[model samples]
Target: MSKGKEMEGEDEIEDLCRNDSKHGSKKRLVARVGGSSSGEPQDADYSVVASLSDELALILARVPRSEYWKFTFVNKRFFSLLKSGELYKIRKEIGVKECSVFMLASGETSWWAFDRQFRSCKKLPILPSDVCFQTGDKESVCAGTHLIVSGKEFEGVVIWRYEFAANKWFKGPNMINPRCLFASATCGTCAFVAGGIGMETNWKVLNSAEKYNPETKSWEPLPGMHRKRKLCSGFCMDNKFYVIGGTNEEGKGLTCAEVFDEKKNDWDLIPNMLKDSPVSTSQSPPLVAVVNNELYSLEASSNELKVYLKGSNSWKNLGPVPVKADVARGWGVAFKSLGDELLVIGASSNSYAGHGMTICTCFPKPQADELHWRSLDKGCTNQMSHFILNCSVMGA
Candidate 1:
């Protein structure tokens, strides 16, 4: 095989060792803490390669933005190995090459990948500059192997699908009406989208929702919500889907929430949203998580985090999201628990004009009620900073 075009897919890389002498037949690459070795470093060569496969797997589990990119320049050998198609699976696992913030004429919208990670905001090959979206309000949901995006840039809403494995985009079944700022979720082989507002000058509220099945590749209408809502939030939990918190046509915030059971093919009202600072209408979906056996949510717009105990059926306001609402931009909060502590990722534009992005991590600072969501970096801001955004936990 030629060195330039040595192999076919990942097999080419595996075959590379057998066919080429340049990659080095006998010398193995090692992982170093500080930098690379002439080959692999000497101090930890054996241990590094001994666990190279597993270590690579762990590195792949890291989110793509800052941590994953750090590994690319670690060493020539590591970079070569990661360039293989096998690493595409890792990139896919890490949600690399997914949606990034793309600024549009209408207020900014986020375009996500099948997995909602690694986004390219500046140049979208197929997505026109006008198209943008935000996933399930509470937490961005993964677009399935077949995924769809809705909402609009200036005039109206249109839904589109992304084929990840094929690296192509296709139009999908449309919604009953054009809307933006609604909740969209995917489970198994189907996708459920509902409740947003119209884009036309009228700015009418939407109560309609729909489901798309991969098997049929067709959409079937679901009963519209009891309330016509705009700016609502929805997510799937315990195999049950929930929609919560959005104002109706009257422009009053809603405490009423609802859930859908797949087996029954029906929707039912759940508990009212926990009483808090008057429900924030400007807020995106309140960030949600399940930590320490309780369901916790963070309202960056309201600067509040609340925990709900299923066992006791009660709510407790935990700690205010360590950053001010003005400081927290869309996609600001990325939540993941490291052992016993819940980590909250917060980022906001340094200015309303959206010149840059600021990222901060909120974890208990060795004490209670003293949360420190420290800024990690500021230079990586993308077009998505102007609107809603999300950070998903990556698993190897």
Candidate 2:
């Protein structure tokens, strides 16, 4: 072959390699560069490799949050994906969420959490030294991904915020009005506490209300309710806060209820909650919660779960809680909505016999007859003797 013809062929081969590289065709570029298809370069195709990593990130985001920490050790890329908020955004978009139950055991300073996916209980970090459980109206509410626990202590009213991402608790801003047994609810990133007994001399019932903003780590006062109530049940639904079934300043059970609208910063009086149920004056405050954007309440006397129908402005009896024969009805009981299940934690009647705790989960059926409940743990009944401060459902 002539030198000029050979040089021209080499130029053509070089031009082909440049074109393939520009078009992102690395496979053909490798074959031509090595001058033989049999022994092509063994290096990875970086563009395809990157695409695989992107796909893996999307898959990992859908994994249960309980397993996210373990996935961080898989690789540097995995760690980055888990640490970034992108995973959570994707999970939200896909509606992939898991709710875990967080409980503050009576008389115990440490908080314990139950993971639904694992069906296991793990202790969170110890509470701050300044924080102690006192005999007052203690409350726990899930605000976004954090848990805010507020209660009366010797030091006065204190609030602590726990972040699941950090696996730790930090002291939050103190409440402007230190009261216990108040109605509390969480809406969006903020939490609201309203109408509780004051910490002063007689522990008088109060009509005051306040809100906490986690982003600013500050508490802002809200318009006080029309009635001074203590031990009222508070819950958030559709961005509205409802306070119901608590004692008034005269220490008498109140049948009427009120709703607070955040945007308007006003309270609207609703029909009496007890008009239909006719709760006895001696009965304790009803346990109330919002599940699936609907309100539910468990009367302490009958232990029957009722769903509030706003359209009708009335309550529908779901049925009596599946209280064990051993568990004394309505003794130190708590009701919370966790994910798709309703969880009840209380003490068995045999609690005095050294039983530790009684925990159960209820699955609601479309038909009343199909509704059922299952006991998750019945090992301890003794813990029932002590007060159950609060129960919260959080996304892990």
TM-score of each: 0.56, 0.73
Could you give candidate 1's per-residue lDDT for residues 240-286 as a string of tens digits? 66677778889888877777777887778755664553576666555
Estimate the overall C-alpha local distance difference test score of candidate 2: 0.66
In model 2, where do residues sit more than 4 Å from their true spots? 1-59, 75-96, 107-109, 130-137, 200-202, 278-283, 324-331, 348-356, 365-370, 377-387
Model 2 weakest lDDT span, ten residues long? 46-55
TM-score of 2: 0.73
Q: Point out where model 1 deviates above 4 Å.
A: 1-126, 129-141, 153-155, 176-178, 198-204, 214-216, 280-282, 289-294, 311-313, 327-356, 360-396
Reference-based lDDT, each prediction: 0.50, 0.66
Poorest 10 consecutive residues of model 1 by lDDT?
A: 25-34
Give lDDT tens digits, candidate 2, residues 25-99. Answer: 535333222233443333333333232233234445557777776665545444544454445544544445778
